[model samples]
Target: MGSVLKLYIQVAFAVKIVSCSITMVDNTTSKSPIDLSTAFLLRVDQSGQGDYKRIQEAIDAVPSNNSELFFIWIKPGIYREKVVVPVDKPFITLSGTEASDTVITWNDSGDIFESPTLTILATDFIARYLTIQNTHGNTGKAVALRVSGDKAAFYGCRITSYQDTLLDDAGRHYYSNCYIEGAVDFIFGNAASLYERCHLHSMAEESGAMMAQKRESPLENTAFIFLGGKITGVGSTFLGRAWGAYSRVVFALTYMSGVVKPEGWNDWGDSSKQRSVYYGEYKCSGPGANRSKRVTWSRSLTKDEAAPFLTKGMIGGRGWLRPSPTHFKKYQTS
Candidate 1:
């Protein structure tokens, strides 16, 4: 009887130890919620003890499948090179040392017949507080930021180019408090994107101000919705033009400058789009917000009609995602 009791006690103790061990392992291996604060900081001045000096190098060094929330903190300086964040690398954060101090300036446009300044093919990526520009001014299709991955976010970053400043190639993306400067078809692509509290600047030209969207699929209700943002441009720019026949875009509760053309939409030389594309606006204010005789195809959306497109769930439903503030803050306001 004594031996049996001792055995039972030992068994209970072993089980407890095993349970604790499993709990510790789970805690250590579980995905850490991404906050911009804990991500790595990349300083361009060669000051930190990080493994790499250049931002691209640092990004490359991260193990491809690293579940850890890796950050590349860029110090104050201009990084002049085309950067590609490929699909295999997810949960990577890129932020500047300071929003105003760090700059990623390059001179290649996708229209250069080959190169694009930045091509992001990774999901769960965040970029903040940096300037991404194609110094090759006025060049056609010069994409400063081309995002082709899902669950990507950009905050307080400046994306500048002449023709195609931002390419929302594919994905569900969030852009908040960022500045995008471009000319014809500047913000074009096939993504379901949301621009909240952003500034869209149109460079001087008669060729319309902003291009709201360019979605390709009828099955894909990909929409670009601008909320509480400002749109200003040079000469006269249409709010958007259909780069794809199935393009869908909306401007809601936005402040517009006179630069927005009354037509609100351009053909982009694709007449077939007139039948399929959907462009609309709601409660827009400013000299350019004139709705008189706006294109028959584009109209103002009712408040109820605009609700679904306004949230992050607009693209992928409720399980979509929430932006990582720490990661996003590192990149916002450039």
Candidate 2:
């Protein structure tokens, strides 16, 4: 009878393991099936303890247009280099244990498109628990991170710079539990993105704007939606300013400190844009969330109006947001 019980327990354990593997490898969250067993893992450690000493070296090893996933585990250290993931390399995950320990920093100011510290041009990329920053202090157009790829997601990351910090350029992106800091037009972009439970800190001394959305036309499906986050900063600032004719941005269920300006939205010195842009806020609390002095062009969204921005569905997250890999195999040099 004792042997019979032991055999039953062993069978149960085997079933549990199998079920967990199925969930990971079967791409349950994605519409398309991803055989995570094929995923490759690379490591970067400055202490001479990994596949490559530098992060870009490991990224260069990935084959162009490869279908397999590559997981680059970055060790705790500060990496000072300019990194770019070309469009050909997709399904790559840059993982670090903690954002405070593993950092990638560069100091470059000017040409926002050409001089970003890190540029992600690949699709289906993920960054987890890493700090990406540009220390071009109060300089002109210094972009810490520029993401132009489609279906990219950043989790537990810290992205910082001065002006034009994060260029959410062109794509459908998701930022969850991240800290973003900057002064003027820091979170500007034309991407259809969802910032969930993130912290946005403004470093402006006098006055600046948190976002400068650049949606050119009403027909374009691009907007910035912030959900369940907190906005705290040093000085007064506007929630957003219209950077395009039909710029759009929204904040819902967020806590805004007194740092936010009474007049929520700016028309970018273009009175013509007041009629085309779509800025809205819903169920937001705190002193800054008060819309008594908000621009007439902006909206205080109702429950029904805010429903669309409330879920991951706005960015089709369920179809592509694979938060974790099934497994990892150590890097092998060929």
Candidate 3:
């Protein structure tokens, strides 16, 4: 009778393992049934224990134009490669345990579009708890990250470079609790993005600009909005420079350190843009937030003027933003 009981216990354990593989909780808020086989979960470990040894290898395994989500869990290691998520592949999440442990770094300088350490050209992409860096020093146009895709979001990530750290190109994007460090036009592009609870650090030796927003025409609904974060840096820097005639950028409910230049904004050497650019500050605190020395064109916004940029509605994030997956479908590929 004792021998029979042992065999039954082993059979029960095997059944439980099989059941767990079939279905999993959805990452989104809805309780809809997500077919586990359609999606996939891949692992990357430098120690050779996981399916793929490199992060890029795992990303390459996903089929083109995939409809379901793919999760690539990267183990703690410094991956020295220039990674790119092509425009055809979307709904991918590249995650790490923490920013300090998992690092993706490259050394490329010159040419803004071609020299990024990591380029995300796919929509509905997510990056979490990872460090993306370009160790190109104070060189020209070395971009650490370039997000040219729509509906991309980053959470708890660190992006560091000297010039053009984050090229927020055409997209409706969101960044939360991220650490972005750079010197000159570090956060530049034409994306309609909202940054929440992020830390913007400057490494300028003497003078620089944090953002260079490029909104060419007034009809184009693109702007960069910063909410609930702190801007601290090493050298004096302007909050932004008008890279286009209708460039727009706003900072609300944030803390600005003394590193911010007194002028606050630059016209990018074109006086005509000074009349068309829209730069606003609302309910900000700290030593560098004084509007007294700010440019005449910049607006100290009223509550009504600031209302439009204070929430996620600015980027229409409620419809597409997804939380980290609570459950994952187990799968492996050689």
Clashes of each: 22, 0, 0
lDDT of 1 by residue, 140-217 (tens): 567788898998888788888887788888888888899999877778778888899999998857765477476777
Clashing pairs in 2: none
Candidate 2 lDDT over residue span 1-334, tens digit each: 6743543343224222232221123322223335654456677889887779999998998878867788787888999999999999999988877899889999999998987988999999999889999998995899999999999999999999989999999989999999999999999889999999999999998889999999999789899999999999998899999999999898999999999999988998999999999999999999999999988899999999999989988789998887465444444544
**Which of the two candidates, 1 or 2, achieves a greater TM-score against the reference?**
2
**Prediction 2 global C-alpha lDDT:** 0.86
> What is candidate 1's CA lDDT for residue 329?
13
Residue 97 lDDT (model 1): 38
CA RMSD of all predictions: 11.7, 6.8, 6.6
- Predicted candidate 3 versus true structure: per-residue lDDT over 222-275, tens digit per residue: 999999999998979999999989999999999999999998999999999988
lDDT of each: 0.71, 0.86, 0.86
